[model samples]
Target: MNNTTQNKPINGNSLIEIGYPENEILGIALKINKKRTGFTKAEMLDKYAQVMSSPQDFTEDKIFKSLAEAFINGIHLPKIDEEIIPLNENPKEFKIYGIEKIEDGALNQMKIAMQLPVTVAGALMPDAHQGYGLPIGGVLATKNAIIPYGVGVDIGCRMALSIYDLPASHYFEHHDILKETLMKNTKFGAGHGFHGKYKAEHHVLDDSKFETNSFINNLKDKAWSQLGSSGGGNHFVEFGLIDFKEDDKKLNIKKGSYLALLTHSGSRGFGATIAGHYTKIAKDICKLPYNAKNLAYLDLDSEAGQEYWLAMNLAGEYASACHEIIHQKITKELGAEVLAKIENHHNFAWKEIYNNEEVIVHRKGATPASKDVMGIIPGSMTAPGFLVRGNGEENSINSASHGAGRQMSRTQAIKSLSQNKINDYLNDFGITLIGSGKDEAPMAYKDIHEVMNAQQDLVDVVATFTPKMVRMADDGSKED
Candidate 1:
């Protein structure tokens, strides 16, 4: 008898060679391997061949039924030209703050998004800029639908600030030590993470959602590897001086300049994977016009929609854990105690009641400025950032700008700016730069003061943070 067990196992490549389409390869290969675990390579190939030859005969076989059906009917993939759903003839009206500052491209995108059948209401923030589907600072509310692109790829991207008991003078005295501490404790750039003894741990890795589906399950290892690490492209960790004009009872600290730590990051590779997977699924299911395809949404009651929701929230929790670990590690290293901490995230969706009806509100790159909510809005590396409280402006969807939005694209900044220009700006502010590209030069972003001024009705400035030393992803890496 032939020893078929010695032959190589049938795999995705093998299926492709036998005329099986690319899209159906994964599902078919997985099912065959899983259901016929004990079968030899020869036996596996013979079974598949038998099913392909007489698919109708195997309709009653539980293991081969789906495969036979698939063979009978060709697999269908989404086509870009197809319009499964038509655009709304009358787009809903949306409020725009600081219209003079926003680019026409961004405004047009917001208009297109409002035309989606699922959209109920929308808003454009003062710092708005053109993004993939919705503008960067766009807030869109949909009825029983969730738009993946409206939430952006960097899910739960946010800011965190920690106030220490040390005086601002401490930064002047131990500037070198502080810089070294940041370099040693933090890992920047895409795919960069701690290894061996330095690897970070967090309870988010234990979340049951990781086991929810094959796609998410495959990402658990990546989440574990990148835990506590900050990814690049506008993301940074800095030592700063915080000045509170007045004593705040909520923070339990007196008004004065104090040493603080501020970090900007998100869920790293974990969120990117989740977004890519679900966004594709959303696009395939809810086809729209070529211009509005990115705004494709998933009905909340569907299984795919539920999976995306779970994955999105898990990313949010993971992002918070990353900030916690960063603060904990650096403070432990310096032997300092944190007196007050504040954090908030954007690029997320929320279920909120609007006009007595529930809707899914997506804030792509806007902060939730609901009444009395606290959030941080950072400027460029050389500019001062602000701490603010929300005013709950209903017309603007209770949101505020996330940052001094980029005035120039990364390519434009790199081509137009120079290292000398970046150095001069940092010198003027007495700020030290560790590792950053010209793409993130201070001049690349809009004036933070102007952005804040434009949204006076949306938020109240509570404090200001001046950067002392900053670290970002080095050159040649994309932002997260």
Candidate 2:
């Protein structure tokens, strides 16, 4: 009588046909109108049609799925604090050294990191460059939480320098043995490991954490397999010469050139898997504002936070073991005695006192420069690395740049650099590079001298290292 055929509404049969349970439909109804209850099929259909025609409706299918998911996940009305906090109109102040040298994108990422609700303080190292979430050389102090990406994909990525009693000439005299040792003792590239009887042996495999933590326990075999290998992308195992200054007390060696084995690596696949797994969980639990998308944090008191803490610390130990095995194997293969070892983990989190309060300090690509702390900061293949002692300045958060940070991205390097030019540059430096790609060429990095000068207040250089022979991953693959 009133063109009723044209005015038919959505029926319960339609909802059933679409596979929504009654409770899901009811939840959607309540979401549309909290007072909605005790509705007949016809009444529900009328309300659905009314809401669908209103401005609130955009996609009917999405609304249905969201309502269904809410029921499945037990999500009801959001709690009072569920809303994302507004971007800090006034981010807490932080320190930045070598500001002029830092890229704008890196600066922006640091600013975003400063806006995180848990961030207590922040600092940018001289080697600052853009990376995922946190800038490469940025340091952040947070309250009772840790950002996984803040520690980086290569968890416990570090620099290890082992000074030997042998003179620098030993490397040149027995170059063949050094070459064979490097080739035999270390495996580079992603997912590559020793076969049969050649696997590295380390005590890190005996840690109880591997048995206790499921995430870490799952990675035990892989971790064991990659124990002594140098995972790629800026990671390297090199034979170098260290010239100690007379005033250097930490090394306490004669002020002359000596053969040193310098290695740059991390926790290998074990770290990468842990980072990826936990970061996703952090995102699910913490609804961060758009600005802090992948920079989410897990509360320290929460179960996940504790688990990650255990895994991360274990990974740090494993990384140290990796360096230990590499250095030990190489030194043993050459029959060289070690004089001193200087090592530090850059990609890690530490429980430290900051501003008279305990905080978790995350250094992505920055070194911990707590007063008199020794760390190794490497340069490009053709450049020099440094053995430095931390000055423990408060403003810079007792941190220094990890290395002469990349001046250009890998894509830029691969696109711009010529293989012939890279070869010529290596030849000029008299450096024999093995198994490296164009992306890690000398031109891709900043001048190490300038970077050291910029962070003079953060650390004091104790010795200088010159790379004589270096090995990295082969080309045509991404290692990190």
Candidate 3:
């Protein structure tokens, strides 16, 4: 059985990959292989090391007679290994609003998230992965205003689909040239160069109202300079089709061959500036009952809030423009026309109505799922991803999980999984990938199928694309 359960469930421990900290990580006993469930993050971290047969060494923290009771009582872990030690740790209980199921690690993250100064309501997408402030796959609804941390620094980072009319065979025809273009023409890793895809300045969108100040002036130039570039990490450009081969039957590939350029990114540094700028502003004000970390409440009538909204929308447009540039460059080489395109903005908040009342929707790693709100959910390098349309599920506040959440951390993936395995996996898929760091290996993420099923009511599947080759650019080592 897989960690992701769609039509055919696969194995979680094997096929499903993760990167948890060694010695710190807790998994079901090796002999048992599969268990119905596992322990919560707190319990695992607190007690699993002692008397536990696990990956990490156990001699770190000895659980003595004088240990805290809460840690001792919180051990409802899966019964697998040769020894079954019942614990009595009292975990900090979290109230599940809409998400009924959550993993131990995700719950721990949620515990931190709940403590964030401002919290509207959050839905833990099944594929929840740990993120900076809020967890990925986290759908948060704010009260009257919004939280920058909840929305995240990567404003409008999203996925763009470029469907080409070229056939799959044609891709192979110019494979070498394509690879060359991806290599010398594109940059990956930390310190990526734009390779001169466009002018060295980002054009300000007409729809926004931010002034032509220094920050905006600098951002505009830098954004345009990065046109057609795929920043490092999980961001990528893959060549794939929308066909599925379940059994001998094939359906809905739209005949012929199509090349899809899919990537996950944002408005670059401009968005980060906005997030940082507004975060400080909100924090400086500190008028909310919540802490500064949760600082927020953007009055539509206020200049600051309105300016941020305008800048945010402009950044979103810039991101779309970046994708368009990439799509155009890729298609120019192939000599094909774009059949259709789709995109969605994540990492930003929007004022939307639910039950006729308007509230701010802050989605960090989430996509808008408001009935026909088109978006894409990308998987790790090794998994298949989905393109979906929102169905307006009110319970979820019209949102869906972003991607397969991370099952393991970067540290763990590097230690337990090998580079050889990564090479072999890519070889089997006939895909050549570049720029994924220790954090972005395929094994580090959760099961996307499980995540999608859990939020079925939030979106309707429009199409599916299996990645072939992915190109991610490096943004240098400047903490990008």
Candidate 4:
């Protein structure tokens, strides 16, 4: 016996070289290796030859019976088909607003998303920027499938505005008191929450849905702790001034400038946990190509999908609760009366009617601009945010930009911008900054005016709110 042949063990490759079908190679090699563990490669080869020569003799043998029968009958093992959902050959046509201002990467992401077999329609807003799965400011409508990434990690992240009856000059008249109230009343940054006397209360924590699943049940305590707290990364609690150039019937306020409180936050740790858990389940069940894996979706009829839907809605409600509590607390502290309130969730999913058919609409970093719907679109810390009324444009899937959108990446902003420059902008705009990093500098965002101009058909600006005092997480946290 040759030494090389004696030492070399039989493997699938060797079986393939011996004219065995690719599908049967694994079974044949495994059977040979298990039944003849101590036998050398030469002995194995000899046995294989014997089996091929007189396959009937080994028909009764447990391990060799199938191998012999397969050889005698010249039959190949059945191949298991991989369950892969391919991209649509003919992708649905999607609309893009402000194409010139949008980066190519974001536009490319939108194009790729439109190619999804589940995707029915999509639209890219003026604020579109590169993000995971769907780009920020990307609105996608799908048929009976929900993509977790499309809803974003910070599920139900939204903007809340409370306009007070006091004049805009009230912010400056009591700047010190107002700034102190924001710092003391709000909690920012990750994992930072109110304790003891500061812990807030909300009715969302009492919902029976929290008891439905172990995953959600465990989040109740965390939700309670962070009930009225604001999370980091573009989340802020600010004192601002809202100017209504003309009388607005919706708010019923006279034409004038009024003091207001604006907040940006979400369900905090609760929503994040739900998103992470369900996104993993979606990826496991929904097998897709490498490029589209992140966009994996869960069938709405499946158990997992139902659970996610419930959990997502609960998180959205919890987020709204956080804002409500924050407003209640601050209003009580300041002894100010709220004249009007406007709020909307950007990162969420809604079952809406499009083309006379029901579809799940996922707005990732985008706002629902359905007809007469009220939403907020914030600018940079120094720029002015807007209160807008939706026009319900069918081409945009009734959506608009969520914010001015990042003109530069956080890393790029940190590398290119300086604290001195940020200070100059704030000073020039008569804005006071409490705690924030250079990454959130005003220069890092697109011009809000230009963004609004580009989406004239999508929404109508009702009023403008200019930040007077801004407070963000001191810790450099990533945007939700």
Q: Please report, in order, the local distance difference test score of every candidate based on alpha carbons.
A: 0.82, 0.77, 0.56, 0.82
Measured by C-alpha RMSD in angstroms, how accurate is candidate 2? 14.8
TM-score attained by model 1: 0.84
Which 10 consecutive positions of candidate 3 have the poorest summed lDDT?
A: 15-24
Tens digit of lDDT per residue, candidate 1, span 367-392? 99999999999998889999899999
Q: Where does candidate 3 stray beyond 4 Å?
A: 1-120, 189-214, 244-257, 287-298, 474-480
Cα-based TM-score, every candidate: 0.84, 0.82, 0.71, 0.83
Evaluated at residue 331, the lDDT of candidate 4 is: 95
lDDT of 4 by residue, 77-178 (tens): 222464777898766788988888899888877888898988999999999988767888999999999998888778899999999989988887899999
Clashing residue pairs in candidate 1 are: 233-479
lDDT of 3 by residue, 1-480 (tens): 122321121232221111111221223322122221342221222122222211122222233222222222323222243232222133233333225445565456556555443344556666665554456666666556656556765567888887676666656777776676555444433223253433433444443344534555545544554554555456677776654233211222464445666766666644655665665455444343221223344555566666667777777777677676666666677677777777877777888775576767777777788877788898777788887879987777788877776677544665688878878878988877765655567777777777787778888776677777777643211121
lDDT: the better of candidates 2 and 4: 4
Model 3 compared with the native: what TM-score?
0.71
Q: In angstroms, what RMSD does candidate 3 have relative to the true structure?
A: 14.7
Ranking by TM-score: 1, 4, 2, 3
